[model samples]
Target: MFSFGLLNLFQLFFLACFCEPAHALAPGSSRVELFKRQNSTVPFEENNGT
Candidate 1:
């Protein structure tokens, strides 16, 4: 019974480690999209200037 509890704890730990990065990556991808949009628009503004 104690070993089962330990196994569950380890599973939870591994799940947390994997899920933590995926959660962070969700926002990280949005941040990258915003950065890409800013970069893409800067060229449009420059083209308008010319």
Candidate 2:
């Protein structure tokens, strides 16, 4: 019984570690996609002191 409980705790720890990164990466990927679009549309204009 004690070993069963330990196994369950380990499973939850792995699940938490896996899920946290999946959640973090989803937004980062979208941000990179948006940056690509912005760069494509905006020309690299040097701002002469306006």
Candidate 3:
């Protein structure tokens, strides 16, 4: 029982370590995608205006 608990703790620790970076980057990546989309649309708008 104690070993099982220890194993669960280790798994949780590893999961947190692995997920931390992905979770941290998720927002930044989404922001970059939004920025890219905005930049791409600006050219289209200007072309339409011309």
Could you tally the backbone clashes for each prediction?
0, 0, 0
- In model 3, which runs have C-alpha deviations exceeding 4 angstroms? 27-50
1 against 2, candidate with superior lDDT: 2
Q: Considering every candidate listed, which one attains the maximal lDDT?
A: 2
lDDT, candidate 1, 1-50, per-residue tens: 99999999999999999997686568547666666678884643433655
The TM-scores of all predictions, comma-separated, are 0.53, 0.54, 0.49
Residue 46 of model 3, lDDT score:
33
Error of 1 at 9 (Å): 0.4
lDDT of 1 at 22: 82
Instruction: Give residue 37's error in model 3 in angstroms.
Output: 16
Please give the CA lDDT of all the candidate structures: 0.75, 0.78, 0.75
Q: Give stretches of model 2 more than 4 Å off.
A: 28-50
Candidate rank order under lDDT: 2, 3, 1
Candidate 3 weakest ten by summed lDDT: 41-50
lDDT of 1: 0.75
Lowest summed lDDT across 10 adjacent residues in model 2 is found at: 24-33
lDDT of 2 at 14: 97
> Cα-based RMSD of the predictions, in order?
6.9, 5.9, 6.8
Model 1 TM-score?
0.53
